[model samples]
Target: MTDGVTAAHGTGGHGEPADAPVSAWVLGADSGGSGLRITLAAVPEGGAPQTVGTVTSTEPVRTGAQGIDAEHMLAQLVPAARELLERAGERAQAAGLRSVCVGAAGMATLGGQLRAELPAALTREFSVRRIALAADAVTAYAGALGQLPGAVVAGGTGLIAMGTDLRNWRRADGWGHLLGDCGSGAWIGQAGLQAAMRAYDGREGGSAALRERAEAVFGAPLSGLPAQLYPRTDRPAVLASFAPEVAACADRDTAASEILRAAAQEIATAAAAVCPAEEGVSVAVTGGLFRIGEPLLAPLREQLHRRAPHAHLTEPAGDPLDGALLIAARLSSDALRLPQDPALLSLT
Candidate 1:
């Protein structure tokens, strides 16, 4: 345990002796799909988190492309992480840093690819001593609940729900756009597009009205979507932005509304599946789709109530950056004791 000061790797490379005494630090990175964001924070002796530096990176690679060459994406992240650390180190020279943690997407569940890559790359450049790599969802959990046994349902291009029993953890979904991601943006947009096509062909089940709207939105019929929507190859990232439109159309179009309602049920089911049916469970809803307000959350809450009647849903207290800082603080203490309220470090 660190009594007052400690030493760790710097932005240059890992495994190197720390140049200065240690204080406490946190670094959080959310990468994958469209862009990456790195946040560096410094926690003074007894003070709250203060921004040290930040960096942003983007990977145009698709999930399909990542499956073939994830290294390409890693290349984009490593440099940004290094940049943030460099700035953090300059600030840390005055305060000292204890630990660094990374909460990145497409890294945790897809094998240890990014896990090993991140450490190796950082070590080659910085002096990071204690480093933790976890799923962005896990980081979101820590940020939203701060070690509590709660779940977070993140709906963007992908939909996933993760929860912890404190000692152990369980995850419900997040199969990606191609496979599942029921209530995700990709799912909504894809469903909308498909309905439009069916309307054009007179083969659509019940999406006639929604189909017409989709055609109006996209100019030509749904068939033109493949090229118009995903012109850059980052199809999921491109398609994800339209999820809100689908939710908007739900009330106006029977087929669209049914699709949205079903999606809510599917997402809530995934969230509930991971949450034990016992009492005193906490749940939070986040992501762009939910930003549309009641059209999403109210339905999702109703669906979750069907199974876990006592589950409580709240807005996320903080974001991934807060989680990174909390994890770093815990590592510095070596007791994993995070702040009682992660929201205390909210970015905004």
Candidate 2:
């Protein structure tokens, strides 16, 4: 019951007459720790789809005992979808949203509610006939390689590596800050802070530079950092905030340099663990962690060279949002081929 219906008039919004045909539309969404992004695209008959409009929400969807809050997500998603539909003009509303794909962070583990409820909700709102709910990692792979055989490493506040041989998915890490997500932003920041603490304790592996940076960033009496950090809900993001300082000190501090090297090794190892064994398989690294530049990427490149020599490293083609769109477009056309899993990707 979202408004803006124009199908009865039949105008295509391109100066076409009331009898002109309108292209079908699809919706794609990416929801993660940062926020949610929704995109609308037009899929013309026998032609490639093109993005028509997009909307973003800075507030991340909430999670609860049942898992990712389905109703909470809908509260944000419905308004965003409607906004896009309106912005794309009356033709888009008339053609209608036929399919939707959502790629969310934690979908593999916390998507039970989303899987159970989202399809029905979208069907009611947009009359969508098909839906694909996927783990953000899977979408990251699609965005990076576009259905090609490859491995994709997504590193942000957390990290995960995903790959496929066009048959099944293989994943490594992404266990969260406390358990795994090794070499992720949180990992790097935690390592840096540990080095800082070691320096404060006059330990053998201590780095005075890291200690200084930590104290400067976290305030004097670094002992107080624990109280400031541990009680928060956004601990991973809070921890990740210090990663840039670690990279900044890498050139002058042996401990920082070693931390980056170790992190790089861990990231490369994860990528190797999931990378398809076929010769010349592609591997791409995506996310904000790499933005720290040479302090991280240089060592990562070296580690990748050593651990995954047969797999060539490449730049990502797009991002998780783009991956969701690709999935939506393919699902609408009945051409989706990515392996499906109840947890990672469920098609309806």
Candidate 3:
């Protein structure tokens, strides 16, 4: 129906104008523990693609026998994609709503395991040309550098660093909050609380500002935390909420300063580890922790200088959501080249 052409539709904020008709459309979605985001965009015959609609909502988590739970992602992705197309009225379906590309957490390793369930779950909702899925990390790399080869460090509630030389893919830490995610907001907050509690216990000295922040977060002195934190559900999220206050205390608070510095070093270590030794490799960073640029990035850059003197640090070209959109675009266009191979998925 599209005749190999596409256009965007829907109405309202982040959506297309009510009067415009779209030739074809596709969705790019990014799903994580926090939420799911989808962008509906238009692809045309000989012109650039444009985003016409954006939708976001929380979705149910799906489970599998091996703990590969991409079905949780598809549950949300399917409904959202259908709803957006419906908003475009009968025109969009008639013109051919093409495909959906998902950049999701835990998807990279799932492979055919996730793919096997796609048709039953997604096609039942709407007809599409095809669906392509990859790990959120893959989308981060593709979204950041496009066809250009390099590494990306995405640190938000969690942390992950990945790089590619077009021939080989290199990856560093992203082990989630418990085992790793050294530079993540969750890490920063938890560490800040522990330090403040140590000072409260008279075991160490900490920043007054951080201690105050911790008290505010816990609704009591540091002594009260151990009981609540250990038994609490959603501990990472609860702890991460205090990260901003810790970042705010930076220069004037020694404990805060040290925490930020340590976080910066951890991020730098991951970023540096993934980049190839070869020169001209660019490193881009994305995450909430990096948002407090000076208190964090200044130290990160310095550490990277010492660690990988040649790697260039730069702002992320886009966020994971943007990366997801880029992935959708690439999947629909054969003319667009990607350097990915099976080995990249192996993360060898």
Query: 18 in model 3: Cα distance from truth in Å?
Result: 14
**Please, what are the lDDT tens digits per residue for candidate 2 over residues 1-348?**
232322222112223333334356888899998788888877665344467667777788898999999999999889878888888888788878889999998899999999999999999998999999999999898878877898999999999999898889999999999999999999999999999999888888988999999999989888898999989999888889999999999999999999999999999999999998899999999999999989999999999999999999999988898889888877888888889988998999
lDDT values, one for every candidate? 0.64, 0.86, 0.70
lDDT of 1 by residue, 1-348 (tens): 101111222232122234333457656565555565666665545444455566665544344533323465556555655555665556654443456676666654452454446566555545566666666777777777766676778777788888766655677778878878888888877777777677788884647766666667777657786678655776776666666777777677777777777888988888888775568778887766677677776787888878667788876767766766666656655656432212111110
Clashing pairs in 3: 15-52, 62-72
lDDT of 3 by residue, 293-318 (tens): 78888888898888888888876767
- What's the TM-score of every candidate structure? 0.76, 0.90, 0.83
Candidate 2: clashing pairs of residues: none
| Best lDDT among the predictions, by candidate number | 2
lDDT for residue 13 in candidate 1, whole number 0-100: 15
TM-score of 2: 0.90
